[model samples]
Target: MSTAYVLVEQNNGQLDHVTAELITAARVLGEVTAVVVGEPGTGQGLAAELGALGASVVVAAESPSVTGRLVLPEVDALHILAAHNPGPIVLSANLGGNEIAGRLAARLASGVLCDVVGINADRTADQSIFGDTIQVSAAVGGASPIYTLRAGAVAGEPVAAAGTLQTLELPAATAKDVTVVSATPAERGDRPELPQAKVVIAGGRGVGSAENFKTVLEPLADVLGAAVGATRDAVDLGYYPGEYQIGQTGVTVSPDVYIGFGISGAIQHTSGMQTAKKVIVVNNDEDAPIFDIADLGVVGDLFDVAPALLEEINKRK
Candidate 1:
């Protein structure tokens, strides 16, 4: 039986959604063992959830140094786990996960498949490339293949398991030349995170300015309870932070409903959000490219349309 190592990420002392997804994907290949890296005991309470999701074992590596050392310690811990269990290594396809997968593959001298959206029964990976213009299948040639899966790309299913917990020990990780002195968290907001939100409201150059975004977009979003996104043009103009930018160069999102205002629908921008289940575009120009993919298109100014829309929505409520 094959054994897969699934990297589990936790936030604010709870297991992130990606962990369950990875577990669900791993079960298709073989038995799953989750590798948790964080403050010691981070995996203790996660056993039941992980087990219920098909993770047979939870290998928790507690290290206060994980925060200070960056990705090196994670590579080391994964390296140790991979040595004992020779199979596929699965991780989220985020920035840090890509880096860690690359380094770990190099350390283990194995080939890697990245940005994987699906895994076949034979273990080959399915990936979307060329600004998501192409869907390709690839297989890594080696004893073990490392994969970085795109977040929200796969649905997680709950499977019964023993839910056993285990601890892994390694030599104290020595802080490398790169030391993180301090870290500040992003300000908290009530809106759902962009990648995970089922509904997203994005603005582009048409929103006019950052101030106007607050005046027009925020209220609509508040009424709909949607996460806010911005186009590359808007982000480059400093109307919003780079993190909120949704395009090929930024984060990819596959929400249930994506609403765009003043967005022209550049290929770079569409690549990231084309997977959304439903797209509604509000633009002044009838010839805008965004209308090509939008399920519903409005040829009017969002400033005029948004306020009325908000009022109507609130009136019904």
Candidate 2:
């Protein structure tokens, strides 16, 4: 079987939620080789987990440079691997992943497919384009096809493999590379990360004010244990932080349940959450565009409905 290289994304020590999905996607192509670019021992640490997730081999490219600098170290590691054992490379379709994919493709002179939702046996991929209004199939004609898969696009299933460990030393950083002097981790609340959350509760301009987001939406989210999201407009209006924005210019989410409160259903926002397994929208405007795709729609004021829902859920709890 051909080898499929999956770039593993991890933080601190825990593997990112997308890593399993990437491994699952790689299985469709051939034997899975999971690549880890981090500090020493990172790959060894994840080998068993990777094997459990269907990665037959785990290539741990450990070096201080990986954490000390930006993007280049990962590119260097993948480039070196491809030089000897070239195959399809799969990465998460996030900001950093896309940049790495572009750089790696340029270095290898290969074609790349970004934001791919599905990969077929024939190697063609399904992509949602034009703000997700169009679904198109894309194929790359090259020795190596680098694909950046959208988060939550593929569900991960365990198919155990050997998970043999291989360590590679990354080249030393050069003057051309950017260096990280210091960093401060963002304070993420107790809620699960938005992309990986099974349930998400999003608010919009109709949420009224920042206080309402804290009072109305947050209480609902707490009851449901759902991640909180906001439309670009809500973010722009300072009702929520930009990092929590869900739309074309922001994060793409595919939760099992996506609940939007007071959103107008703009294409930009829907495109991000359209892949959600079940969509529920609460909008006073019955004709709101969001209702077009909602699995459940409630025509009511979010402030009123949200509190009642929260109270009822609290009762049930």
Query: Which candidate has the top score in TM-score?
Result: 2
| lDDT by residue for model 2 (214-311), tens | 98898888879899999999999999999998978788888999999989999999989988999999999999999999999999988789889988
Q: What C-alpha lDDT, on a 0 to 100 scale, does residue 281 get in candidate 1?
A: 93
**How do the predictions measure up, each by TM-score?**
0.95, 0.96
* Residues 111-176, model 1: lDDT tens digits: 999889888768899998887889999998777789998877787787888778988874575535
Query: Which stretches of candidate 1 lie above 4 Å from their native place?
Result: 175-177
Q: For model 2, what is the error of residue 118's alpha carbon versus the real structure, in angstroms, after optimal superposition?
A: 1.3
RMSD of 1: 1.6
| Colliding pairs, model 2 | none
Error of 2 at 303 (Å): 1.6
User: Superposing all C-alpha atoms, what RMSD in Å does each candidate have to the true structure?
Assistant: 1.6, 1.3
Where is the poorest 10-residue window by lDDT in model 1? 169-178
